[model samples]
Target: MTDDGFMGPPWQMDWTPKAQAVRDTLPEHVRKTVDAVRAELVTAKDPYFRGVDTDADLPDGMKVRPIQSSVPKGPRIFFFGHGHGWLRHTFVRRVEDPQIVVEEVFWQ
Candidate 1:
């Protein structure tokens, strides 16, 4: 949440419950990948390797159909892990430079 401006829609970190019951509800791969993504996201700034798409731009009308994720008009990305039933989901698309306008789009 730096002066980097609105990096996209407001998002919250993992809200998974600490309860054992909820822990065992999702598929094994989902849980494992979630942890994997979590571990990477915890250190997204490292260049050696990276997790999650923090700096990537989201194109208009784009949808993550190949994976178990959703990208509403709010323009953000979501975890491909277990679907959070009713938990609030957020979309974020990075917008670079407030200046330099042009006629075409640049998918940086």
Candidate 2:
């Protein structure tokens, strides 16, 4: 198992068709930030992505939080999360097994 308690080499990240569609709608810079976050999930040893918050509505250890911004103005300038601006939201759900599934990415 990995350091984050996930099975295999590290965390595995994947996107669904719906998620892909949402991601595609984002601006280039915002998409790049989201991509970086996803890459961090696959490479980072921490399973919970440490800094991100848990999704309040979803039970069973699901986490949802906005991705950090690289720009000085912050994530608000490019994406939208929970109806905000240029925000990138990541969704991680832990299954019964030792796997961590990235269920969705919200880019609105």
Candidate 3:
């Protein structure tokens, strides 16, 4: 936990260009939804592993093979821990120092 006493993920997370690009295209309402999800991650005690659904498909041409987990939320805007309604696919990883790096975002 930081000085704010919030219990977030074992690592901090941030948006990659991919995620940001998707966010930039969303409507204000949808963006708010994605924003809320991100805020939750910031305060979540296990953001990396929380709310992860392995059945979700990545943006790659591959189908949903139950081999990956994504953080899809709020009508599917598609973020790392974001995605509201207009975004598509995203990847995230935890760094050695306990930080989650949002790798990329993709569309179908």
Candidate 4:
């Protein structure tokens, strides 16, 4: 149980985890390419991050940022957690063909 008092896992767990879906959705060749992308990421000093990931072979409107917190700084990719309300149904984390930009970095 969490402080919000719900008796369940922190995440809904209704959908497959994002990275697996990306691998499953691609053709074998594409999957291999994705694997290579991942291979270059895994265990590397460079960071991997994403905001709102999806099961596809393209950018997820993600802000691929350089993590200069340490050496070999590069894009950091990690999946986004679900948005609280309607966003989950309306959004699947695919980078829109027309990119979305967030001008301000807001942290509470």
For each candidate, the alpha-carbon lDDT, in order, equals 0.31, 0.45, 0.42, 0.30
Ranking by TM-score: 2, 3, 4, 1
Best by lDDT: 2
Backbone clash pairs for candidate 1 read 76-91, 76-92
Give candidate 1 regions above 4 Å deviation. 1-23, 46-76, 81-108
Per-model TM-score, in order, reads 0.30, 0.45, 0.45, 0.30
Order of models, best lDDT first: 2, 3, 1, 4
lDDT of 4 at 16: 32
Per-residue lDDT of candidate 1, residues 1-108 (tens digit): 446654322222333243234435657755554444434333344211223653353222221221233422322233243333211222223454211111111111
Give stretches of model 4 more than 4 Å off.
Answer: 1-16, 48-108
**Which digits, one per residue and each the tens of the lDDT, describe model 2 over residues 1-108?**
556654543555556677678778888976766665555445544443344342332223223343454432222111223333332333353543433344455553
Candidate 4 Cα lDDT to native: 0.30
Find the 10 residues in a row with the least total lDDT in model 3: 60-69
Worst 10 residues of 2 by lDDT: 72-81
TM-score of 2: 0.45
Query: How badly does each model clash, as a count of residue pairs?
Result: 2, 6, 6, 9
Better of 1 and 4 by lDDT: 1
